[model samples]
Target: MRIIQLFQVALVLMLLALSNEGRVNGERGDRQCEFNPSLSPRPHSVSILEFGAVGDGKTLNTIAFQNAIFYLKSFSDKGGAQLYVPPGTWLTESFNLTSHLTLFLEKGAVIIGSQ
Candidate 1:
């Protein structure tokens, strides 16, 4: 009787496994994978210096940073924007970020926060 019960359990497990496989295969057949270029954001780069940010390591650049971020927000629809920090010691305060904006820092670029 114990051997018969084990055989029945094994058969049920096999059926469940087969049913799951069939469901997964059917779903994959319904949808095909493809790449869409429009789905990706277009790349745009802007320098902090354009916004009057001085990286002298002493000047307060809070307003400069704010202006740069605001400018980038305007291009949020055109594939977003990228703020590039060149090789300099930028000193600024906290700032907010918009969607689809990328902050890129080059080598030797340092951002110092003012307390």
Candidate 2:
């Protein structure tokens, strides 16, 4: 009976130690993959408003987003570009995004999908 109890305690301790080891390794891995967008700034920046986007939550801005992306695609060879979304409720439909572009949203900015 004594041997059985000791064996059960040992098994529990082993499992706890293994779980702690995995948790510590996961924490370290996450730190390495962390990204801060503010740290890396885009070369060129343009606002969605420049493309005639009205962010009143009722306005459909799908074309504005599409046009903005199409215009920004030209700067891809220069150094990439950024599409800045100001604080407001922007209703838009699905649109294609280009490569080497950063879609930066300001604080309080919300994007609502319009199907």
Which of the numbered candidates is closest to the native, going by highest TM-score? 2
Regions of model 1 farther than 4 Å from truth: 1-42
Q: Give a tens-digit lDDT track for model 1, residues 23-114.
A: 56556345433653453434776899898888889988889888888988888888898888898898888888788888877778899998
Reference-based lDDT, each prediction: 0.82, 0.90
Q: In model 2, which runs have C-alpha deviations exceeding 4 angstroms?
A: 1-38
Candidate 2 lDDT over residue span 22-67, tens digit each: 3565564334435654557779999999999998999999999999
The model with the greatest lDDT is: 2
- lDDT for residue 64 in candidate 1, whole number 0-100: 85
Tell me the TM-score of model 2.
0.67
